[model samples]
Target: MDALWEGFQEAVRLIVRGDAGLREVAWRTIVVSGSATLLAMAAGVPTGYGLARGRFPGRTLVLSAVNTGMGMPPVVVGLIVWLFLVRSGPLGDLELIYTKRAMVVAQFLIAVPLVIGFTAAAVQALPAELPDLLAALGAGRLRTLWLLAREAQLGILAAVMAGFGGVISEVGASMTVGGNIQGDTRVLTTAIVTETSRGENANAMALGIVLLVMAFAVNLLLTAVQQRRRR
Candidate 1:
């Protein structure tokens, strides 16, 4: 309990003093996780929409794969990415291992399925004739998709939050693929792990507190926007 109190004090002190290292870690966390979420949103939204609307051969197989991915262990995701990007492995000549890029890739893979699943569910819950109605109103493909998206914006926002949350909070994959290199690949979650392992309980707890606050802030902003849109 004392340790936790000290940690909170330390965290406040760090924040009030504008600690450089903490700022960097926080920024990097946003950049990496934000990039992953954006990429996932771009790819997953369309893929999910297609899944919900189009019927083709092997569609079930693809959905099953996405469903499985949504629940797969983060460590396993890291290992799979590590193998493909490791030295002597195929496509590893780019030397991306243990870098922020690698972490982003791993995180993107982790978040995409959640985005896809949520997006498909959201779109599926919409009226079946939405597309037809839009077309009847002289809406082209792009316009129709746009309108449908507006109607389903709430669910899409939920997908965004889920994807962002999943990647931002995961340490296993980030540590595995990123090597947790200080000033390079260390994120909030990994930083907390490192501090705790080194017996820096106050520092670890401070980082944990920062992480929770960051996550909550982001979600709060998203929720505000979501609610505003509904009105």
Candidate 2:
């Protein structure tokens, strides 16, 4: 209990004193995770819509793959990404290994399936005739998609929250691909790991507090948006 209290105090001090390292790690975390979430949404939303609305063959198989991906281990995803970006790998020419971009890619892969699965479920839950009704009313394909998305906005927002949550809390993928380099690829999760490994328990706890706060802040903002939309 005493140690925990001291760690909390250290965390407060770190925040109150505007610790540079803490700020850097927090900002990097947001940027990398935020970018990845956005990219995943962009790709996943359409893929999900197609899966939900289209009647193509192998659709079931594809959805099963996405469901599997949602449960896939983060470390495995990191290893796969690392393999692709490593020297002598097919994509090695881009030299993305051990960088923030690499971390974003890994995190993006991690978030995309969750977004897709949630989005597909959301779209599927809508009135079965919604798409047909829109088409009968002469709505273009893009416009129909837009209307359906608006109708399913709540589920879509939930998808966004899930994606953000998954990527923000992940450590193995970020550490493996980002290398947790100081002021470079270091993020809150990886930073906490690094601090704990170095036996800086108080510092590790402080970073953990910062991470929790950051995650809460972002989720709070999203929740606000979600609730407002509901109203």
Q: Candidate 2: where is the Cα deviation over 4 Å?
A: none
Clashes of 2: 0
Model 1: per-residue Cα lDDT over 10-126, one tens digit each: 999989999999999999999999999999999999998899888999999999999999998888999999999988778589799999999999999999999998889889999
User: Which TM-score value belongs to model 1?
Assistant: 0.98
RMSD from true fold, candidate 2: 1.0
- For each candidate in turn, the TM-score is 0.98, 0.97
Model 2 residue pairs with clashes: none
Whole-model lDDT, candidate 1? 0.93
lDDT of 1 at 59: 90
Across 52-168, the per-residue lDDT of candidate 2 in tens digits comes to 988999999999999999998899999999999997788999999999999999999999999999999999999999989999999999999999999988999899999999999
TM-score computed on alpha carbons, candidate 2: 0.97
Residue 205 C-alpha lDDT in model 2: 89
